[model samples]
Target: MSSTANTTYTTFTGWVDPPTDIRPPLTENFTCSVAVIGGGLAGMATALRLAERGVDTVLLESDFCGHGAGSRNAGQLASAPGGDIQLLNLLYRKGMPAIIRLTENAAGHVESMIEKLGIDCDYEAVGNVFAAVSRGQLGRTRRIAKILRRAGAHVEEGTARELGIPHGFLGGMREIKGGIMNPGKLLRGLRSAVLASTVRVFEQSKVVDIVRGNGGVTVETPGGVILAQKVVLATNAYAGEWDITPKRLSSPMWVTEVETEPISPQRLAALGWTSRSGLITQHNIMENYRLTARNTIVFGVRQIERAASYPLPERHPDPAVVADLAKAFARRFPPLADVAIDRTWGGWIGITSTWLPVAGTVGDDVYYSLACNGHGLAQATYVGTLIADRIATGITPDDLRTIWVDEPKFGHAVPMIMGRLGLRAAWTADRFNDMINGSKRHAREGFATAAGGFTAPA
Candidate 1:
């Protein structure tokens, strides 16, 4: 809460403003070879690929493309999969290697795409770190590093000094494959490419219903109906808007991101963040911090708010949550404690039951990809391209086959349980651990009144 009352709350992301050149909504009935629903990163990539292959494709979006998590994410292209690697390994032992390979390759795909598209998104090849704030988290990092390395991921474990991170952290493992970038610019670049290509794009086109009859699927928006041979539903968090989507396909979680007022170069350099790698704390609900090219630092997501119903409403970051995040910022980057929070924003992102990125077919002509989890930056784009290729040529690539599900059935309502009460419990546990760690640190430092005075990072 450290005097973050001046922070500007925004419904959209703080990365970039809403695009001025919004494409007109569909106004007439149309037929096409393929129709892509939801113009986020995945849909745009899918339609773009289809158009490049000479397929008559139409991309339908409620808002402008990249308006969702595509532009709102922290922009860390992770080499390893999202969620706990140890859990993933224990659950899907044999699938771990393929998943690891896919994630690393996904990051490479983004790097290559950035170069090929000539995007000036302030991309830095400095890989991201799975940082540890306490001794328990440091041990967790070591164990996770071992799991990742056994699965063939390129990672390094070391102390904060060796990793070039801030001294506030004990140590962490660095994923050497992926890096950080200006996701807003990257999305704009992709949007430009899609608009320039032959793919017909319609903005502000809210789809009302989707009906499959005879040989084609009829996608109905408010203004018109589109009859296409195939349909690709790439809507991330809004997938629940359609009844056709699988039960428990994913959960929509609202996470916030806040940026600090610009800091001087000397102040930033004093933190010894030489590697300039984005840092993600190893908590149950992770907190991510990254330095922007604008000389400001952006961090968020210590707590998550899950949506109650579908058609997720547009909203700003909760003030209480933003305050909590600011307190966390002060602890993690004490050098920037006095820095004012410039603005705060929140976006809806989908997390699968398994905490894995998934792509599959609902029927014969309907295809879907959802829940890139938190690794949507690289994973979504790559999976979208794979889906496009699969539809373009009648063959599925091995990489695509790795995550492709034969049956679209999913487990019970796990996300609902993880929503409010579960989140509160997890937060309480983290805080309790932090208190214990703080007491130990104070005892070592010979502080007599450590019990009530110490507040540690967890």
Candidate 2:
């Protein structure tokens, strides 16, 4: 059967080129002990885990590795694993340790995978700076630093003035282990590692349907089919049309990133940003800034609502996103007021309502793994490994396995309808809330509700 669905998602920084290829379609009915769906980081990790166990498995991709959000993302290698403890404590109540391990290690796992497989994805561990753009954000960052310290993660206190910063910040939080990376190279390395294994990896073989028979499950694709006793679904934003879509806890959110032509090393030194570190302003609507290996200045923040207001223009990047990016860059880096923007790209990020990962067996033969809440670059891989391990060992504990699989208010058919609408309202409301000194809080909270959940604490 042929199906026509407006099911495509777009990204801003990543529409440039496709990843190196592997092989071709299945071209025949094949059977394995397990079948994994979606070829992004999560899917790749799941398949790699299964393969490591010497389990017979088949991995399916709608497009190619990293072709989706996997490859198109701004590669932020988070070292300290896990979510905000306060929010996790609220959502999980007494349940925290296991989920933290699964989500937080995702950041570390990125580095581990790169080292283990010798994949050169520009893995660096220079550290990340989380600063407050206002008094409210200052308090929040301080509290966040306390939480990380209590959790035993390495952290430090740094003031914007001491750090020689921009945007006129009061103070900041520092996480030294977090680093920068080339997202596409990371995904490419994983794909190469998976393909080199005995595990079967197939591309351009989009799954059309899934069936659970008396014996096992079967994943049907246009070119071929995969029959297995178990299956894993790792498609994040693109998995919306499936029965498992509701399993995601947060709503679909969009983000955009822009890269500038390399500023001379001398220019960077003069700007006080030559140090190997990334920075984020904890404003109402947060903004992140980083210096790339090539000395280019990159910045990312909330832009999904704006992108929805304007789809992928026939032109490379919608002028709105480009223009807004230019404005944001100038505001953050007044010294680089004359910098040239090389390119801009955007990608969709999945979030969960509970502000935690949602992973568990949907049916007996099928399992779900998704919603890292913009932390998928690491969390997804960590969650994917846990899911694969549990499935392999058949150890599905209620506390760990059953905690998040059912979190609510996630997945979107086309979020521009409501999500983008909420963003606009929040932007308007935030400006008004500023008079009462609650502008940042109100705006962040607004976007959280627009996302159908409370935004995770800073």
Top candidate when judged by lDDT against the true structure: 1
Error of 2 at 48 (Å): 1.1
Cα deviation in Å at residue 68, candidate 1? Answer: 0.5
lDDT tens digits by residue: candidate 1, 1-458 = 34586888888888998899999999999799999999888999899889999999999999899889999888888888998777788888888889888999999989998999898889999999999988889999999999899989999999888999877788899999888888988999999999999999999998888888867999999999999999999998898899888778788889999999999999999988889999998888899999899999988898988889977998998998999999988877777789989999989988876778889988879999888888989999999999999999989988899999879677653444466898888878877887787678667555535544544323
TM-score of each: 0.96, 0.82
* lDDT for each candidate structure: 0.88, 0.66
Model 2's number of clashes is 13
lDDT of 2: 0.66
Per-residue lDDT tens digits of candidate 2, residues 11-74? 4244236765646877899789988888888999999988998889899887676666677666
Which candidate has the top score in TM-score? 1
Q: Between which residue pairs do clashes occur in model 1? A: none
